[model samples]
Target: MHGKTSLIEHNGEGVFQGLNNPLTVTRYHSLVIDPPTLPSEFNVTARSASGEIMGIRHREWDLEGVQFHPESILSEQGHQLLANFLKR
Candidate 1:
């Protein structure tokens, strides 16, 4: 999954809390063709400017995922995001 860039806007209340900026750029490939219906145990933590789901977490499980590649150079604050995940 690699191509254009997307804006990941943090919801500011989950794993992404305390981020220096509310939005960051990241490389994205896959598109959420359908609106997701996440399980009740999961909480959405971020989204694209167009409202696509970009990040999610399960608080109880200490699990999380993002549609964009945080390791990619295109991601602003990618290191911080990874650090936050690691600190959790």
Candidate 2:
């Protein structure tokens, strides 16, 4: 589930997912070296538990993160976590 990094000094910490598409994987590597450079700001969006966005996952071409694990009560009202983190 992990891929090795090229940096011998900071290597062995593989964050890449092996199951990712080859093209997507290539793009990921490129991004790691030359990041797309976002606005340096945080923007969190709210999504319902039963909503269509919670279960989505992507890489390179798209990016997403889930504030809730949804498997237990640990993530209770997880959307609030995103909200608070974005409050600056």
Candidate 3:
């Protein structure tokens, strides 16, 4: 999967959720950036709340992005992304 894009928060009766995109299990509180096939020169945008960038990491040969689903697909770039984040 790509990642959470253009999502909005949903709240009701003390329950919160995100819609209009991938359901983010992550509350955008802490992001362990795991760059996948994404290029290093590319600027990844992470708008958690209001207007602000959570964090960004510079790398030599790896890339990563957000994903609502736990990607363990070997065919996908999930491993690469995780490796990148852990390796960095």
Clash counts for the predictions, in order: 0, 0, 5
lDDT of 1 by residue, 5-79 (tens): 776677775557677455666665776624456877877778888888888888698788877877778777778
Report the C-alpha lDDT of model 2 over 1-88, residue by residue, as the tens digit.
1231211111111221221211111011222211233223422222232221222223332444433342233333334434433553
Sort the predicted structures by lDDT, highest score first. 1, 3, 2
CA lDDT scores, all candidates in order? 0.73, 0.25, 0.34
TM accuracy, model 2: 0.19
Off by over 4 Å in 1: none
Q: Which stretches of candidate 2 lie over 4 Å from their true place?
A: 1-42, 47-60, 73-88
Better of 1 and 3 by TM-score: 1
Tens digits of per-residue lDDT, candidate 3, 5-74, equal 3232222111111222222333323434444654556454343343333233234434434423224332
Q: Which candidate ranks first by TM-score, i.e. highest?
A: 1
Better of 2 and 3 by TM-score: 3
| Pairs that clash in candidate 2 | none
